[model samples]
Target: MKKTLIAYFTRTGITKKLAENTAKQTGADLFAIEPVKEYSSSYLICVGQAKLENLQNARPAMKAKPQNLQDYDTIVVMFPIWWFTCPNIILT
Candidate 1:
């Protein structure tokens, strides 16, 4: 059987919940793509930061990453849309 991985970045808990459900159904390993510097809890503040990052074409640093990515035959990435695209951290 091919090994699968579900990697996700979530600001609110919504995307995390979806990733967890998908992982359960697919029997895949879960990896949280966290940023080294967390965004502000306030939605407005976060939006501002995300907008700036987008304008700068930034790739925020991650706190952790999956090892041996070659081991997984399939990898699913999930994240909420920020500035009409995935958050900058997802690029890390």
Candidate 2:
């Protein structure tokens, strides 16, 4: 059987919940894509930061990446939409 991985990035925990539930139902390994520098908890500040990053086409540093990522035959990425797309941190 092919191994499956569920990788996700979440700001408000909503995407995390969905990722966890999906992983549970699909029997997939879960990986959280975290940034090296955490974003502000303030929604407005975070949105502003996201907007700036998007405008600059920035790729923020990540805390870690899944080990043996190539071993998984299927990888599902989950994240909340930021400026009409995935967050910049996910690009790291």
Candidate 3:
């Protein structure tokens, strides 16, 4: 059987939920994009961290990167939009 990959990042789970739906429909393997350093779930802290990173032009490193990228012909990337932008810097 062929396999597919669906990688996603969600701070508040909205995008996570959507990714799940896509996976369900497509029978794809889902992987969460997590940072090397976990952060508090608090909205205040999330905002602060985002701002700090943006100010420093720093991208929080991810805990893991996609391995065996060629194994899956279909790769679906799902993430949330913050400040009217998708933070591409978080891609690892």
Alpha-carbon TM-score of each model against the true structure: 0.95, 0.94, 0.83
The prediction achieving the highest TM-score against the true structure is 1
RMSD (Å) of each candidate, 1 decimal: 0.8, 0.9, 1.9
- The reply for model 1, stretches above 4 Å from the true place, is none
Better of 1 and 3 by TM-score: 1
Worst 10 residues of 2 by lDDT: 83-92
lDDT of 1 at 6: 96
Q: Per-residue lDDT for 1-92 in model 1, tens only?
A: 79999999888889999999999998999999999999999999998998999889899999987999999999999999875778899887
TM-score quality measure for candidate 1: 0.95
Tens-digit lDDT track for model 2 on 3-27? Answer: 9999999988999999999999999
Candidate with the larger TM-score of 2 and 3: 2
Clashing pairs in 3: none
Sorted by lDDT (best first), the order is 1, 2, 3
Give residue 53's error in model 1 in angstroms.
0.6
Candidate 3 ranges with C-alpha deviation above 4 Å: 1-3
